[model samples]
Target: LQKLRSGQDFNSSHQYPQLLPRRHCGKGLIDGEKSTPSATLYEFPWIAKLFNRALGYNCLGTLISHRYILTSENCINFYFIPDLIVLGEYDNFREPDCQLEDPTDCAPPLRLYEVEYVVRNHNDYRYRIDLIRTTENVAFEDHIQPVCLPLTSELKHFRPSQYTIAGWNKNSKNTTGIIQKETIYAASSAECQINEEHLPHNVLLYTTSHENVANRTYSGGPVGAIVPSSERRFVQFALVISPVERCVVALDIVPYIDWIRANMVE
Candidate 1:
């Protein structure tokens, strides 16, 4: 709490040792069993891993504020508090640490939190709108920062025509242990429906190969784009709501921008 409130230098200040930025993040799997670390891997620091108490990592969420975590409603319920929220986590195989010096030695140091509440949407049950708050305040760093919610101007001018979806796999026959990235091409709303055939109302679609293994864990994950025209770096355009054989369905952020701004921690 002191480091979070004191605003110490994240990389250099040892007095606030807990605020140091992580050195490295993760490698991406091209197919199923290779490690390819990206130089721009840390671009999406706001992505979070939601781990259930009884189960392991359940889905992905976004760290929108120091106190609040945004995730899908279907991912969590009102009855239970999640076990932990891991921020800046890359490979699930490595033990989550916050101060590891070597990337090969371990995954970067992870900022973890205890769940405080599960805020649900009152209007639509399937919308899976939830605000999971932490018991304590979060300390932001180079490796851990909130993603900017898309504003009207930002979305209209900067949204990408293509984006990437990221997910993880453990190691072994059941898993491979590194994060996987898949490129999804943007489609018109009508074309999205025609392609997928079952894209729910109010949802957007991105193109997929239907053969990528990464698509399996893509549900409840992030789809971010590096908008070239606007010169905007990776801005998360949507959350993976559902995955079909040909296309992936995501909730359109345009309609919910007002709702997000209102409910998020200011």
Candidate 2:
């Protein structure tokens, strides 16, 4: 707490180039879980809650950098406009969110940032992605950090057999703000074609959910893939575009990796 208050270096990239092996990307979640369940305190730290002017959480976004958030164009569409972005938050109802298993273990207070502006992809582009710039650079901590983007050549072509989708439970009965996760597998070409969803000749990458996304609103949520050979590090390869009944459609991050990097600056 003192370190966080005093603004001490919590192993920034310069101090530890790898963002500290302890809090690397996708470090949370115990191994071996097949069903959707409430996530642990520090799982998916990059998940950001988007809030509108009314101060209500509207959608989900991913922390891709200290100053930028990666979201979907639909989030800032005609109906919803997320003006505030909250990080390091596990439960919306409580501050200094603590672990359910261990009351003594708690995360730091959630950090809120005002959105400076939003940049949308070219109107001609088929994918719907938006980059949000925050007024201030978010401080990185154990419970708040950026996720790994697919920038390397290997990651660009890499595909995992199983993917993880993490976001808040939108069920009216359970609005505790406890983050949840579901495991989804890559749909075969026959399944993708069955939907009759056509993509541009150049845009050949995408995935669909096998079952309902646990009734969770994955709009702007992260579709994470486990990195091979890494120490359980997960990479953000896609963002949830929409949920169609029991099937969820997502846009591949590889197509927008360069666009994201180019617009990361203010």
Candidate 3:
């Protein structure tokens, strides 16, 4: 049994490398000639301060509702507190820095909110050793809304090919920091699972580099699938970011949404 376990570990480990650089820049409403405004992306006021202060930075999250934002558990570690600004309809590239000077005055169509609660998955891999769990719901101070949790039974029905991931990760191999929007299609679980650059055990071995993985600043960003609504509106909220081993493309496995509802939501 021990040998089997060891072999399983080795096989899984060999499937992925410790790092995989992002090769494609995704297309989105935020990109292109007639792009969505930068304000549409969520931003954190306190984190913006940290960014201006020259502390290390990362990006990870998605807007699930007009009010609620969904992101990875690790992203909370990057901030000192939950005071954040949701950019709703911005376009200027330099607006993030300019808004930092006067957060109230910045005309970036920002909706400032505070995190009220945070819900995290109990099965979060990071908890394997420390058992230190985080809450998944980060409730807001204002009326910013909560994202609808995907049904547990529906997770298997999710087609990996039908999803998109967006973020502002690094753009170069040598440079350490930059904030830019990029997107990529979802690769198959088997593809992700078999890739030697993202094995589970290796992810545990190299946590810090994992944070720096993706090509255009993914980190704590959102991986979502657009589900059509009866009313003709499309709702997108697929995965919340989680830490993984490899640096290949900063794409950590999103905890199964069903698992999140069972463990985190009230």
Candidate 4:
């Protein structure tokens, strides 16, 4: 488990170099190579694709479920009904360089589905505007599979600790449309609360860039935790992305697991 750094100063203006290639070079192999998914906010099962013929640009999204996806509400609000595609168990953007020796490859082909709708949290506090936007309960289509909501009782099990996050976010300002991966540890509520003072609401968001970069896009991404199961295996999904002030510390308003089951589930 990764230890939390107390009083660690993360500057918002420090710039970092671009780590990965922008376009798919078709070099990275799928077999043997591990997929470092983004931290929660960027690690949605589905990638959102935004395209404006005149502007010429696009974005990606993580799949929450067959129907529902947890992404930045702002991204969707700005770019509505942009083409969306859900890639299942997809680790590499380029094709596999070598033949797959693992049995999982033969288990079944990962399905690529289309997004039908989107639902954002109405309760999500929006800044930069006087009008408050109500959170949408849910958005999905009949054909996609929905992820199960963790019970309220399950919240106690998820503590601030080590976990994996994945996404196809820009690695640096010079690049465009490349997926990068990073791992982050959970922050304590006290730490989050302290940082919230510098932020808009009592919300905190996560990001790989400790310092804010010009094109560091991490608006609507998944922020999940890996928890231990009774079978000695670990399961993830402690939180989903919600609006927050800044990405100072890897903090965001994770929908309280209990709150989700109370309102969204029967």
lDDT of each: 0.58, 0.70, 0.33, 0.34
- Tens-place lDDT per residue, model 4, 1-266, is 21111111223364433321112111112222444332221123333333334443333444333233444445544444443343433333323211134423321233443333333345445521011111232233221223323333554445646543444434544442334444555554454445445554534444333333223443444444433443222233433243223222332433433222222211
lDDT string for model 2 (104-180, tens) is 99998988898877777764556577887788988888898788877679877887887888777777584667887
Worst 10 residues of 1 by lDDT: 1-10
lDDT of 1 by residue, 42-122 (tens): 545777888876777767887766777666666765343466898876655555522223444433577889876565555
Superposition error at 249 for model 4 (Å): 5.8
Q: What digit string (tens of lDDT, one per residue) describes model 3 on residues 103-130? A: 5643333343444444444342452110
State how far residue 22 of model 4 sits from its true place (Å): 37
> Pairing residues by index, what is the TM-score of model 4?
0.50
Poorest lDDT segment (10 consecutive residues) of candidate 3: 1-10
> Any runs in candidate 1 off by more than 4 Å, and if so which?
1-43, 78-81, 95-108, 156-158, 170-175, 188-199, 213-215, 229-231
Clash pairs for candidate 1: 73-128, 97-109, 97-110, 98-109, 169-177, 170-177
lDDT of 2: 0.70
Q: In candidate 4, residue 40 scores what lDDT?
A: 21
